[model samples]
Target: MMRRLCWLVMILAWSTWGAAAVEREAQRPAALSVYQDLGGTLNVEQVAALPEAVFRELPERRFFHEYSHSAFWLRLQMSAEQREAHRHWLSVGDPRLSDIQVYVPDGNGWQRMQAGAAHPPESWPVVARQPLFRLQATEQVVLIRVVGDSLLVVEPLLRSDGELLAQRRAIAVADGLTLGIVLLVVPLSLVIGFIMRSSLLAAHAAAVLSYILLVCVVNGYLVHWPMLVPWTSYIRAFASLVGFVCFLGYLRVLLQVARLPSLWARLYDGVLAAYLASALWVVFVDHVQGRFLTEWVMRLAAYGLLPLTLLTAWRRGLPLVWMAWAVPLLYLLQFLARYVFQADHLPWQARQESYSISSTLPGVALLTCTLMTELYRSRARQRWAQQERSQRRLEARGRLEAAVARRTEQLRTSLDARGALLARLGQELRGPLLDIIGSARRLVAMSSSDYPQRIERNARSQLELIEDLAALSHRDELPGPSLRAGSLHAFWREMVEEAELLAARQNNRFQWRLGGNVPCEVMADFGHLRRILLNLLGNAAKFTREGSITLGLDCLERDGQRVRLRFSVEDTGIGIHPDDRVRLGQPFVRGRNVEWIDGFGLGLDIVRQLLEGMNSVLHLADDDRPGSRFSFEVCLMLAGVQDVASVEAGA
Candidate 1:
């Protein structure tokens, strides 16, 4: 009976122990947060030697994070059973990390193993994008210390050899596709860039090349391509920023941002400058700071404003609006993937297997697609336009020949076949010639108080005007710019006298509003300056009839010795219609407002060419009063009284 009781009690005790152990096993979590961050200051040896009490538990070890110029100590504990029987491999998700120091508990101390981009490639146990480390089976703690430039989101992965191999195969396939696409794009981008022969395409290629290098560096491909190792940080940061700038460039061309408000254009410029500054900082000063600057600030400015800019353009009925919205949408998705969910924290295996998408690779892929689409459409349109232009040219030539034949016939009839010179003059000065013929006939038939003298003087003036026109038509140049010290007061006074005669012929009001501060003399090409004023004033007089014509000269910029003078001619006559504004300066193109006016349509075009020779440009203004207002500036050296006296004596 005593032996039986002992046996039963032993059985009961064994059953109780088994049940308690089962309950404990069931309560333990399958996945544990084994790693702890003892912060940045602790070195591997010191950390390894520290007791468990000094470490705090990292409750959410799964949430990997990024920090600037920071170090982290991570510890993973293994049980005796795990150490004795099973071999484990550790995986790092980000290849951009500069340093990863792993320590294994050996006897009473720690054994340090270095593996990361900072170390040589051959030293690594496994040749992979995400560096893999083989952990020696031990019953003690494993600790890893890490740091990098764009070092973000390191979540240590522990797997069996089989699992690691499987992951390697999977990642190899994923990277093959991603990297393959990137490599493919390089040549295609180059070919497209050459074919397009556009700066936007060149800019796109630059952005793409930067992106390619960035991806290669991120994937630890630099382990093979050692030549690029020195530029990893610069390439990655440059990729993001340049991609943004190029996107803006595309926006500028496609949306024609210059047509947008000046404020909007200035905003684009500011963002571009900001990105360039950040890129420079990354290349020369602080890589970490630049990385964050581009990722957070530059990206926000670019992506946020890009969509709005595109949307505004679309609303204004610009082409490529679909792409404008599409590209931004892709970027928005990427932004959420990177910032909100922190998809970068996902395991490399998961990311490669498409359980999650990385931000950079996919974003670049989308951007490239959109760019190519836009370029393709543009090329197609250009080709179509060329064909249309050719067709129009052929048609225009035929019509021009017909019109010239008809004009020649009309002039021959009007002149009654009176030799070649008279017929030529008839077509050259058709409107003025008709008036001259009528006046001559009237003088012969009727007597007036002073008609004969007036007619003779008018004929002489007309002959002089024809001579001037002939000089302008001599295509060599406006007599090469003879820059010299000349008096503005004298030049304007003489020009005003001629302008009055011109204004008197049409009974138009001529007003000279010279500023009191106008310089007496300045350095300029007197011939060209005089011609410029003549053209502006002449155009004002021709376009105005029984209306006011104003000639104005003023100082725009003044220094002690140098001054910039602005000459303007404003008229109250037939104003230039908005539709004809763009056509005004083209050769042989006439403004609708000047249809009844007598001109060969070469005045404004000749004026533009003349101003260009003198390093100036013709600026047209919105005629708030009535007619067209034309203005231009000339940089002249102010001349003293002695220089004027010498010039007058020489003349």
Candidate 2:
């Protein structure tokens, strides 16, 4: 009976203490109803003077108004005992709010404390990423006003100092990590874009940069960097606009709109234009309306247009296009969940500012992977193309070698036949030609008739033609010039006589001109030189009828042991047609105008070949005197020691 009484006494004491504790907890301040200043014109004094029935209560502690033009007012009612028991703080969870003012009752009037993006962090009652204010011990009624252009989520929290400090620290850590990620991803995207020279990568980099800027502005990091604080509003607006534009541009490039069907391509272009126009509106027009337009446009692109475009590109053989859009789509969903739907109850909803900023990483990583894969595929294609080209070239070379071998064998056989035919012709024709020439000479000696001389000259010309044909056939086998010391004066006199005789055949007059500085003696192959001049003079003489032919020699330059001489043969006859000049040096090719009077057209070609062997080129100079002139320059060693020594001394 004594033990039972003791237990009952203990249980009774515990029950009384628990009941009192429950009553005390129920009395503690729990919920504070929020109110809106719909007109946004109410001052702290007016709001304080208004009755409690004037303001409408919020459904919860949180409110979201995208681009709110009016201010929101929150009235927290607390007893002096409750305020003293808990050293409370009024924390506005949004950092992007443009203006925040807290009114704490101070004796007879209100002591106002300010914190928001509008006021720099230095002036804040508690310096943190979000607006925080400490409530006074005696304050019973606190008025909080919030205003901004950004999407407003006013989550006013009444917490103790330790809870506020812990929240601030968590926010700081999240923001720091976000900043670190942005810093890492942005430059990396830029570098990869630049290195790869990829339009897709470049567009992605621009999107990342612009989106990060928007994230920084929205997260209220501008206050940390004071230089950016003044242009906070402008930065936020422009960053949002540019971010949307960049994302659309990235999608366009990734989809390769040019390769899409015409209708889809045009639709993509139209949407892109709309985005660009919205960005312009944000800059030059009202930002609030412009941002509203931009948001809708972004939603259309991100949710509707981009997916369709990706689908179109995928069907058209771009299999990886969907993979590229996956991360961005995920980011978009996250954005919708957090800002649009206000689903703060989700697991990932904590530290949403950090989540929004750091979400760019997955997209960047996806882009990097896509670019690397593309690079690898490109290298593979290049290697395959190189191998294919090499294989084709090898096959072509083998065919060419076989063709060349067959052609060489045929040429060898044909050359043997040509040699036999030439030998037979030489044996058969030379005897008759010799007989005809001997008879003509005898007839010429027997009678003073011009016909015998004509016959003899014709026979000699025929013999010369035959010799030119033989030379043309064996040109490649010909030896170099056999240089010998010779007198240039004597050689010139002999050439002049021959030229005059040849010219007289066509009733043409021949003239010779020698420069004053023509060398007296030179070391040259007179045989080849004589043949060259004979061919040119013969051509001139043969083409001209009752016209004049002139052969000129000039000393172009005189060095110590070498004399460069210019030789020219000019004819005042039917000049060579421009169209026929190009064919003049080809074997069996003659000027079109001179076709009626020519033998086999082997003279000029033979002249060209001989000049080539002697390191000279034949040039046809344009003459304004109704004639064509063929000129060539040749360098010969001065044979006379006295002449060379004189030239050296003069030099």
Candidate 3:
């Protein structure tokens, strides 16, 4: 009897322990699994009809498929205790999912609940940051249908209302802090960039703002706002595309890519353009294809081009280029672990909130540090530039002062030279005036024919001197000669008469020679021609005493209506000295050997000025004869007989 009682007591105790263990197990949340509907045609009835074996148990608490067109069906089997609690809620953690339909068992029917970006929060069965469905007391199974246009990540959880509220409160505080920091940092960066006028800073700020916006979209912060709900579908794609583009721009500026080789700069620009096109494609075209292309392009830029450019910049001696590798390296590790290696079991992958914060915060910090370092370098460069500019200004001031002093000295020397020239000119004029006065007094006392001629010659010399002075003073404003057709023979006869008078004063024999080919009627400026020849013949006559002077004309060439003629004057007088050649053709300047001659040195200067106006040159030839030979060539238009008649008739 004692053995039987011991056996029964042990059985009852073992049964009680097993029942308590069963009760504890019943209170725990149900295990969730997923079914991929490749055709996306499965309804709740069809999914329910399918065998449980067709569904695969999800290995991680949260499942991630970057982007997919296929629909996913999630099945959750609730424990008896969870069903009886009447407070358990089934939550789909991603708010950006395009469509989420939860079918909760109610009595014999299924209570369908809709929530997600597609449905407004007001119509949701239970409004929250993400989709939520209240579990019925008698519910045993919950079916969730999910469809997404962007990155598809689903984390389904079964928890009581109190637990969910507590978890959300914690998330809200963390999100608030993150958003506050973003708001503070974004505007601060912009203000600083504007103040400094730094493109690098502005690009960095743009990148930060865009990336934070992407994070907000991914983490479902924007979808909760009523105004933002309409854009929830496309916001993720837009943010991602814009973020990558902005990041590339930031890198381009940071690496000083414009300063790089043309090939590298072009490559960076192509990548930037591709990213921008992708962004526009997402907004205006098909979002799914756009996002797919964007991902591929972003990967190419971030993984291939970006790293190579960084390496190139580092090799090319860009300062702090190595520091820019931190963000990319961090991103590479995160990408490899999350996507390539399928490290979804990690603690960070439990919630996108944590994952986004973890992935982005470090990159933001690294980029910020790199930018700050660049900012310091930029400030240093500005300082160096300022110092260089100041030094250049001082050098320019010194040069300007020296130039001003040199110009002042030059003006002073010119003024002194002009004063001496004026004194000499006055002395020359006084001698001529005194000669005229003495000749006039002699004519008045004796009434001799020689006194009249002597007085007339002195008066002519004074008049010539005054005329030369006037021509020199108005040399800059002189008009070119007016050309007209006239008889060359008649013109020369008049000129010869004047030349004979000049030659007679010095007892010099004057001879004239004209070429046989010389045209009778030719276009010529008569006034200028007369002045030029008379000056040459008079100079010859003055310099020669009882010496023969010859005036010669030759027709060099004739082409149709134009005739090229050369004129020459030769005198048997003192020739030009070698030392005086360089100093000739200057106003108020006389040859050293000609100081004893009674004349001012304005003849050659006037001849040069007049010839320049006529597009001709005065030439002094080396001669075997005792005197100088002056020659010049001019082209004249041949005129008809009627033209000469008209000219004579007009005269």
Candidate 1 segments exceeding 4 Å error: 1-39, 49-63, 79-85, 120-128, 198-205, 226-231, 238-241, 261-265, 279-290, 311-321, 332-383, 386-651
| Per-residue lDDT value at 210 in model 2 | 84
Report the C-alpha lDDT of model 3 over 117-148, residue by residue, as the tens digit.
77776778866666677776777778889988
**Alpha carbon lDDT at 140, candidate 2:** 73
Best by lDDT: 3
Question: What is the C-alpha lDDT profile of model 1 across 1-651, one tens digit per residue?
Answer: 336535543554454444334323221112323334435676767666677666556554443554466676666766666555454777644676777787777777777777666776666677556777787765456777877766455666666666655556555555455555556665666677677665555555566566555556565676666555556666666666656766667667645677777887998888888888877887788876776675665566656877787778778776554555666676686677766877865433233322122333554455466456757778898999999999999999999999999999997665454434444664477567557756876776677565554464456455544544544444323445777777777777777877898788789988988886788878787666666777777777777789988898888878898888888888887878899887878867887756777787877877887788878898889646668788898887888889988987998
Question: What residue pairs are clashing in model 3?
Answer: none
lDDT of each structure? 0.66, 0.73, 0.74
TM-scores for all candidates?
0.49, 0.53, 0.53
TM-score between candidate 1 and the true structure: 0.49
Please report how far candidate 3 places residue 619 from its true position, in Å: 72
List candidate 3 stretches off by more than 4 Å. Answer: 1-28, 59-61, 84-86, 272-290, 314-358, 389-651
Whole-model alpha-carbon lDDT for candidate 2: 0.73
